[model samples]
Target: MAFEPRQTSVGGNIRQAGERLFAIVEGALEEEREQLALWVPVAMGMGIVAWFLLPNRLEWLGFCCFSLAMAAGGMLLPAGGRVRQAIVLGGILACVGCVLVWGKAMAWGTPPLPRAAFMEVTGEVRSVSAIPAQQMSRMLVRPIDAPALPRQIRVNIAQKDVPEGLGEGAIVRFRARLMPPAPPSLPGGYDFARRAYFQGIGATGRALKPVKVLRPSTSAPPLRARLFAHITGRVEGPGAGIAAALATGDQGAIAEEDAEAMRRSGLAHLLSISGLHVTALIGAVIFLLMRVMALSRRAALDWPLMLIAAAGGALAGIGYTLLTGAEVPTVRSCVAALLVLGGLALGRDAITLRLVAAGAVVVLIFWPEALVGPSFQMSFAAVIALVALSEHPRFRAFAAARDEHWLRRVGRSLGAMLLTGFAVELVLAPIALLHFHKAGMLGAFANLLAIPLTTFVVMPLEAMALLLDIGGLGAPFWWLTARSLDLLLVIAHGVSASPWAVMMTPTLPTGVFAAAILGGLWCLLWRSWWRWAGLIPIAAGVAVMSMASPPDILVTSDGRHVAVRASTGGMALLRAGAGDYVRDMMAESAGFDGEMSALADLPEARCSDDLCAVRLDVNGRAWRLLLTRSDMLIDKAALQDDCASADIVVSDRRLPPWCRPRWLKADRRLLWRTGGLAIDLNQGRISGTKIASDAHPWIVPAVRNRKARSGNQL
Candidate 1:
């Protein structure tokens, strides 16, 4: 009898604990019921990412079919509990997203130029972008008779070579040297070829001679062009480019030095047409419209002035978006603004994660490729973090509190701005590191002054100047706008000059990036105490990234340039005369901002006419690298002996089968297969921008030229 009573007591205690755990989970689910829809876009974005990561279009097609089947099956599932329903819905949305991006890639992907060529090009100009800093202009052209070329090609023409009145819709003929869109200079670097493919740009080239205009444009110039010209003409000096970039989305005119300063100081977002500019414009319009409409007492008393003002703001936002070429960031902002306006008209609060999610879905539906871009990731991340911060109970209570003194209110406003900036920076740091390998350390402080100045003084003055220019009364506003821009540039340069301005990092692994992003989203998306648990993954990602090491050797796709890590923890270039573009790319990839030394000057390197031999200490072992310096034939015996002894070999010429390196043979043949390479001796790994086996529309597989057998036989 005693043993039976003890067993019953233990069973009763276990049953009570299980019931409590179930109740807790059920409560959490109920609390999050209304927020379930917010994850739909996130699931879709995951699918889009998967599509991009897949190796080939055939696999993408197969995945699309699989996704569709899953979605269909999800629809047929029985009415389960909320957890099952949520899982099924998320799976369905993810499938839809995968299918959507696959379809877009099929419809929009363009074939890249197979090889470089010099040809007489006759085409109609579809669009033109000026690069006054370089004294050049680029045009998007549709070929007249070249059936072998892509539908559109971007050609750069010198200022002196550009024909007169060669605007959009003009027929022109010119002799040009064209080349395939360049691939990433280093592994994990920017993929210019992929970007160009999606943009319908197959080739890029520079004109050899002056362009001749066969026919002039019949229609008037685009409004965006007109506005750009007007702003550049009105404002003198570097400020003109800044003003133009702010008004329109064309950033080509900005001086390179000035743009770099802006980027380093974290003020570059001001140059882009994004949420800040759109919100300022819409808010100003609504404020002015309400004031004007409410001035009529009868209208204010009886009319829906708020609704009318909201409509006016929406129209202004839409017009601004179109005027700025409807770039992705501008379009995203416009969509979000329109949603907010709709909420205002309906008397509901709408500046929430749900609103952001809706805007993301709309953009993804049309431009799924944007999911991979830095702009979309950073913009959405900042917004999500800010919204989540604002929704916090403590933040809401503080914001809603009434201040007794005007100074206290001002302090409160500033505090709020500071908090919001910190949150944005926190969330966007990983993304910036992933894309650019650097994040602005002082961006929060810089934005405190830059955001207000651009929002209140520069943009408003520019808008007024453009508006008043219709009556020839814009001189004063134009001057004020220019002065404001000058101040903004000053701030940018001053902040960027600080030694602690930026935090540079080595290329982040994709898994680390994913962990950070997921953790941030978890922290931002959830409304319960468990959301704080996301910090564990975020911390873990940071820890891993801090311990990660950069590659020891970097090689270009063509094997023309090589950068090796020196004992001083800096990069040394095989060719000292390599252009700034190549040097900077190598430096960035190596996460070394200091000056690069010449390999010949290093004590561990010896250079001859045809080859440069280097010795690097990696993982406590001396690694020998034989890099070709010239195309001249090397002594066969000496080359084979060197290759046999070397750990890695790089050359533009194909090596013989007997001349094999123990670790890697990154010669012409291998480089042709794996675009650009990063070799990590510490990890015994090699990463390429384009994998040897990767098959994609934008990637042209390399094939050996049967006739080119002169060098290999030696």
Candidate 2:
């Protein structure tokens, strides 16, 4: 059908165009945005750090391709020389990266597949998780499990008394977990397991059981290592564990409950060495350094104090990130600090949205994986929102009305907390459902409760406590920091008690997610007043969430367990002692409330002294089936009316010699039937292979192999 052009209101059309323009401008602001806009580079820088951390060769090749394209484009860009130089420099770095990866690949046949198991690993108390530094003394053990041992085992020891001077390189012996490190899921998702594989850690353990420290093990280091460790020990006192964690990010003391609280509240980022922490630290350090430099002539003008401080902060940020497991978040912070410093060195006006954005793009080109991580997504979402808001008339009005009064400051904090909490939650909610199958509603509130305490109270106290430790005064600060940490924990507990704290759920369709984002862009980017687009995600969230239809019938690791949710909403679950993964998936995909209702006990349908058998009258058909941990068999109880009625049997046992119409897994929700009867699976989809435990799900959708459809998209 030929579509006719309908006249639309000028205002409405303008709004649409304006939003597209806003998305473009906000994205372009990477070149520069007043104040916080330069965060794009920060995001990008972190991505580069992630790129360097991986042991993959394909990604290196991809990184090279992206760098070359970006470098070529930079020359033609109307941006500043510095921007162009960074791009070119990135390309040069890419070449070096290619060489390095090439060497590693050549040496190891491939980048290095993850290890199956590490034998008899023997190591020491290299690092520990802390509560708040200068507080209660505790350390986590990443026990050594070497490759020579037939099996990996984890050994934990919590010491009651320790020499105050015992430091790093404290040797110990033990077994580690024999985990077959989980492989990568998506192209660019974080791979801590793989990273651990390279780090020689086979298992993680807590210092639960007390182990006698034979003596302080001895080890020497390069000048840099010793200096860094000395500084680390001085700042992160032996006692103030959480303080050390704040500085170094070893979260051993962040009890599981505390960690869960932070995660649920969405305030976990505050404790980590993410951008917020680094920015605050950089600002503090620059102010301190400039003041100090003002006192000396050579240091003042000769060193370009701001530039020097930025550089110094960058180094310190990177160092801190390394201590905090050198994970993705820290890497991003370090990248941001360096980019900000680079801006200072060039005498650029200020870090702009466009510049940082360009940096982020560059980073993504090199490490596409960052695009999928929650940290990267949330950090960028917040940055972009803030940048867009900065350019809006309403924000300017609000800022003019209330600059910095105490009440205004509190209001601003409240406002920022509200905005950040909601923005991050909303942005990542869809993906959160896909991953953990839960939506923490009060996460923002949790963060609000925790962040201030962390920034103003915990971090500061921890830093001070670290200094005290190297000196003899660590014990005094430990008490105060511990108390502060406790208060933070208390706040988390209070907030988490709320009924809306979390919602366990399933993922939304991709189409809906896209619509929500587009709708959000309307409110976030193009703004004069709130409009229709802004309401998309909210309305979609409510409508679609309310209308979601979950499947029934769950199968477990053992074929013996079968959970079926009938059409009447009645659930029948076979008593399977271990069905954690199956139960979790169901709980995640089906609403927690639904799961609560859908759970039912299953008494054995049949037991036999001779041939083990179970019988079920399903969909008006009499079928006798053999149920074993391995497989199953199906037959018509009577040969006459039900011969064509009974569907093919599913089992770990070999396929029947008869019809091969289809097979399915017990876990799958899909249902099938023979001839005229559509055997309603009261549950859901089940594939032939799934039930048989012989093939992959993808093979079904791809029923026709490549040979049959060589030229087809299929």
Candidate 3:
């Protein structure tokens, strides 16, 4: 065929369509400029306010350093050689400067603190994680600072220790030395230090010896402790507290089962008090109150009423945030909502891209660490996606069609919801998976149902509770809502049970996900269609998986212990017992079905179908083998023979410490059954065969040292 000159016609049509699209976007951008300008400064101001309000309050000195750094970073911004590079580089340096300032302030402020050696320190538990409210514990600790060392030591218990009954707000002093957290016992397992780094915990008191709580002139109460206590006390109803949690993201009273349900159902954001909660509150309150006002002729005409309701909603949002301890997510959501709502109240407009950017810059300046958190990314992503997708002029075309049928309106809502979910998840998923290690395959589906429920059902009930409490009849509402919550949980559990609900554990490296998210963001925000480039990071992530060298052992931080999971094989617990959450995390991450297997299974899950046992004889000692759930055992007589024949015998457990497997719990291979006259396998491999001990063994440094803790006094 001749070269198709006919394509010339299509090309013109495509160019025309592109021009029209560009015109539409340019118009919208023009409309948004004013709103953007006003919000930018307001949000920036609030961020500064937060910096002043945030605890670990380092006023002048820290502020000076940050101001200088921001000024320095400002230089790179105008270079304009590369926008993305500038933003990234400046953000990184700013973050580093802030972290340094914060760390220094934490270390140097107040009483002269001393580093505590584990051996020298005698500490007492201040608090531990007995509930979802506080994930970890605080210990009243002292440092084992002697002649050679003079560093302040603080110990944080992995789990919460403060009694739910005693409450965290109480002030107490520990007369003990603090020890830093220890690293994980196994290579490629969880990195405790890294986890703590993210968590902002500096030291741990795992080896602390209990000492009397001193009443000696105590210091000021910790901000978190006071905040936790205040939140716990405010909401007293059964579901009222939980509802308040959803309303305020103050999970001080929410049950763990509910949290699990939310996670399984992909509604975890509901409890986060971030974009989801704030958006729902803003929309629901605005729509309802505005409608109520619009209905009344007098109220409709009265701008005062509209202002009052908007103010009410804003106040409610702020109050809820305070109750939740005003953590980073709530603060961001509140600030964002405040900007939009303030714009509306001022008759200005809505938030614009410039506004979002300015708000982000200011927020980062204050809580620079938040720039690296999911809240910062997801919150901004969701907001920007909503603005871009919802404010399209094409929505005008649906106006005529909506008049024809009610179903059309509902359908449009659903469609909008789906579009929003897709847009935001597309933006947030990469980072979510990278940081969290799992992606909800059907989070969009779950969130579709959940969004309306939260807006319509959850928030309404919580609002009503406050009113009912004033009338002394909150119990009824609480009981009624609790049942409704159960239904939501059932839905969550059911959806979670669906095979497609959640993706299997997948590897998500840091930079790769960051790249993907940035690409998606570029696609979403840029006037260019190149946002489709978001696919690059996703593809990179997928490609990485093919050659992914997953940690040999997988571990999760539960604020208490690191749950060990196996990716390929060769995973074992160093200690005899681990917490339930750790076990569950290990099982889930490794895709094990609660079996003894590590990956897809722990090391010893033979199941009821197989019953095998063995005893190894080495150096005249018979050692029983480690049996997972498998009905495997060693022969008494044969064990004796092997012991006589071999040099060193091995058992999975420390049977009086003599027969202890010299290797870590999961390191040893299955030795053959001592008394096997049974079973045959086609392969040469046997689950019960004696294997050579690994030659180049790994030795993890001991996280705890009894000798080190003892100081000159000891």
**TM-scores of the models, in the order given:** 0.93, 0.60, 0.61
Ranking by lDDT: 1, 2, 3
**Pick by TM-score: 1 or 3, better one:** 1
Candidate 2 CA-lDDT value: 0.49
Off by over 4 Å in 2: 1-245, 295-304, 342-352, 400-409, 509-546, 556-576, 579-586, 593-714
Per-residue lDDT of 226-299 in model 2, one digit per residue for the tens?
43344344432232334445665555444455666666665566565677777767766776777888899878
**Weakest ten-residue segment in model 1 by summed lDDT:** 702-711
Worst 10 residues of 3 by lDDT: 671-680
Q: How well does candidate 2 match the true structure in TM-score terms?
A: 0.60
Cand. 1 Cα-lDDT: 0.86
lDDT by residue for model 1 (61-83), tens: 67766766765666664455465
Best model per lDDT: 1
lDDT of 1 at 254: 91
Cα-based lDDT for every prediction: 0.86, 0.49, 0.48
